[model samples]
Target: VDGNNVIRKIPCMQLLPIILFLIACLYQGERLDHRSCEALEVILKSLHFDFINLQATQLEENGASSLLDMILYYESTTHLDISDNSGMGTSGWRALAHLIKQSVCLSRLDVYNIPMVGYPALSLSKALLTSRLTVLHLHNAQLSGMPIYTLVAALKVNKALRELHLTNNQLNSYQDALQLGDLLQYNSTLKTLELSNNALADAGNMFVFTKLPLNICQSH
Candidate 1:
């Protein structure tokens, strides 16, 4: 069935708030930094909306918080794509970290190109310690140098995660690649590990390549 037709089949009164919010979010071909928790609740209860895309929304800290609230408070949302939200700042990342720490229902998270560093990264790393996320995408989130180790630390204990994408974040150094190789060596639950588009020299890439067991590539 067509998606719009499926949406149309829903009771108008039940879906009105969600439709209005989406319309407002789409006016002028831009996603507004606005959210209604009431509307989100209605959508969740009525339609069981499980996926959300807030990509390139120009969302600031407040908007990001609101989105995080839905993921944290609601029980339905499992997959969220917040990629290219360059306007989201420290508060936003922190809020999401908090959500990750507490929410068990969120399984897949995408936050590519949303610069995060320092304490926020560490906090997020700590949150990943107990998170239920299975698929994680952090491409170009400036997760090189020291910050990459934070995630490495979490992956050491994160048995639930299955796929990790760390593309284009300059894993050029031997030490970082070696650490990642060590993680790949130990973490058995993980099936797919993507390190493409990085700044790795031949030696660095080769080091990680050598660490990955042949079965790691074929597991999933």
Candidate 2:
């Protein structure tokens, strides 16, 4: 569902308030150099149908905080994309955690290609552990690899999460790989797990060995 399209459908008489709100918030951060929040709020308000796309839009900590505020303020959202946001570093992930811990509505978050996420990966991991998520993607994002455990733990309890993607990440040490295998044994909700294009060696290969579906796992 395109909320933007629906927002366009409302009669001019009924949509004036929303328009005003958008104008007020869309660039609200321009002054403080942090307009992502107000703009995000506008986006949320516009989506009356289902699904919202915020993918790779360069949202920073300020915008992420605002998104979190709205999520908590409204008891969570269904879809969100935070990938490639140059501003969302360690601090931003922590802010997101605060909101995720409170509400379980966020089912998808794409934070790929973020160079500054290594330190904050733990914060995101913690959020996933306690919160409810269904889809998680962190492709090619810089990370300390600490969050992998949090991810492992979350996979066990995250009944809603069905897909996880961390392709090209640096999570391929022996211990980490083995730990992931252990976690997968208990993870019944996930249907797709992507750990490709990483530093997987023989140890890592053995971790997912026969467990991975033949369709998804190939080659040596």
Candidate 3:
């Protein structure tokens, strides 16, 4: 059988693995550039994958932006893991926020170790207001007081999010705990909250725990 004919015969559920295999073979240990990302877009445009992992792809700002733009063509993607891309800057982060707000099927996002302290955090918070995301992992993303406050505020009105991870974000202050406590009171959709490695003091922890629901899973 011809390779093209065999691929055409593959079921939709099985096609993702095959495509991922091809991508791995073609770009193993290689840094992705705009041209490479555009080529990838062409390859992926005709296919649908629920999960797209671009972790540690060595993506620079421009390359990251291009990759994000390419992902916009696949609205059916539900889970996106872009963790460990240390070179992504303002434009890349902004593009990611835009993608989140525009995505119709995205529900889970993992952006671990990305710097989301200032404008990036604010942008993501705004996107959360209208996003369909249910699980969000921002571990080690430098989410301290103000950033945490903004994100919690957004979550207050965002009914779609269910799980949130903010581990190692230096959330040690009472105000940080207070914001989270307030979130528990107003946001009913959040079910799992991970706060490990943070130094939330006894008072802070106590305040947040007081408002925590019995059914909700929480760690501090």
Candidate 4:
């Protein structure tokens, strides 16, 4: 049960040993449930693809870690989805951020239905600072308030970012969207933005994000 030793031994290992263990002291062989996922991990690792959609909400948290490691570390995936999980709380988001910090192949991410509560902003801001992410999806995720400064900083260097989706989240106000407009005014990387079903109704138009190249001061 030495966690450190296990981690140290594996230490970002790629190929998982496809083992058919006996839990009830009965050898099940390929009848084991995890074998399918392990086989998938091996296949993905061998192909060297850059994306995987982990939309299966039922994957256990521990198993998710292994699958994430396989895709991120071995396959160098730049895009991932861990959407619609029952137990995927803030801790999962933090773990994804940890992986993002270490991930060089990852550039875009979609975390569905998770609560942000400032962590997404913080994590993504950090990720954008160190990584080459170009797209992000936080649909239906719980996020309160507009992270103006973080978004500002993120937009400055996030050259790869071309689209942003914040649908069905709590953004508090339009200031950040407007600030995002200002950012788009100077930073031409982003072209499409979706803030639908958010708290963006305040002293502005949706056209602002679309008309970023023109005068932000133009009457709406």
Candidate 5:
């Protein structure tokens, strides 16, 4: 969905006085400054939207943390797309992890194109254990090494997630595939798994495909 079009469609009366400024900054592709973040926090407290898209808004660690903090107060948001915010780092991911664990309505999250390497991955992995998220997108999220392994470990026990996308994350290692295979064996709730563009070899693929159960609707 085009975020700008959605913003334009909203009735002006429903928006607070600061909403116009927020919209103008977003339309200009301006990085949200401290003042803007504060204004956005205020706007979010009163206005509720099921889906919120802040993709590529240049939300560095502080901005990301502030936005996620504001979102904690609004439980009506069900789907959140914060993908492509390259500047988000460990702090941002940490805040997101907290949000995932606390949110009552958030069921779908798109972190596509964000770098979730190192400790950030660990933070998110821990959150997944308790998160109510059903659909998660992590395409190109730098989940190559221990990150993939950690994520797989979490999914093994996570019963809430139903759809997972892990495409283009360089998950070709035999151990990584083994971990994922184990996840599939234990996780009965997952219905779809998308692993396109990864270099999982025949040996690695075997560990995944052979473990698929009839309940699993798709794996590609």
Candidate 6:
């Protein structure tokens, strides 16, 4: 079938249309790009709310494009699970940044195993600047070096995030933990922090707890 006909069959599942379009294009051996994603964006306004779970499949750039469009254009979706999918790339991360820039309605973001580096890291950092995410999980996704620093900087200004899981992401140095500790000193909204199996020194771990806010509920 042609692209127009495939687009016509797209349902109200938000990003699902983009995935279908992508499949049709691939079956016909055509390249996919942002233009199709833009077309799918036109139908997003009709969706009231969404709780999509694309964790089972290997989400590729097309899926990321669609997801990013949903994040950028729609405000009704509250829960999105993109865990265990290693198909997203730099472009996808960049798209996610746009969503973060435009929306503050996302409460939970699970981006586990989607490795990000370079500009994409910068974009996610930018999202943290204004994102209303209450539970943010970036487990073992190579978020070291500058990305960690950027996240720490955003935490200083972010007031809505409650749970931050940086489990097993190679956060080994004491200074890194100290930097996070410094942010927690000023951030009272965050309650639980999971930093297990990292390279945290005993003293650094001690400092993190000492610097934690008085109202913290848990930190594992």
Scored by CA lDDT, what does every candidate get? Answer: 0.73, 0.63, 0.82, 0.58, 0.81, 0.69
Off by over 4 Å in 5: 1-29
Instruction: Pick out the ten consecutive residues of candidate 2 with the lowest summed lDDT.
Output: 25-34
The predicted structure with the larger lDDT, 2 or 4, is: 2
Per-residue alpha-carbon lDDT of model 4 for 143-207, expressed as tens digits?
Answer: 54455557567667766766677787655445555665666666666656676776666544563
Candidate 2 regions exceeding 4 Å error are 1-33, 39-43, 75-77, 89-91, 115-119, 143-145, 210-220
Can you write out model 6's per-residue Cα lDDT over 1-220, one digit (the tens) per residue? 4555555666647557666564455324233344544554544554544564445355467667675777556774676666676656766777677776667676787777766567766788888888878888888777766778877888888888899888878776566877778778878888888887677878778888788777776555
Candidate 2 lDDT tens digits, 58-155: 56666666666775676535766555566765556777777666665677777667753455666766676767777788777743255666567666
lDDT of 3 at 13: 88
Q: Residues 136-191, candidate 3, lDDT per residue (tens digit)?
A: 99989888778988998899999899999888988875788889899998988888
Compared with the true structure, the alpha-carbon lDDT of candidate 3 equals 0.82
**Clashing pairs counted in every model:** 0, 5, 0, 2, 0, 1
lDDT, residue 63, model 4? 49
TM-scores, each model vs. reference: 0.80, 0.70, 0.86, 0.64, 0.86, 0.74
Overall local distance difference test of candidate 2: 0.63
TM-score of model 4 vs. true structure:
0.64
* Poorest 10 consecutive residues by lDDT, candidate 3: 25-34
Identify the superior model by TM-score, candidate 2 or candidate 3.
3
Give stretches of model 6 more than 4 Å off: 1-46
List the lowest-lDDT window of 10 residues for candidate 6. Answer: 25-34
lDDT of 4 at 52: 58
Candidate 4 lDDT trough over 10 residues, lowest sum: 19-28
State the weakest 10-residue window (summed lDDT) of model 5: 27-36
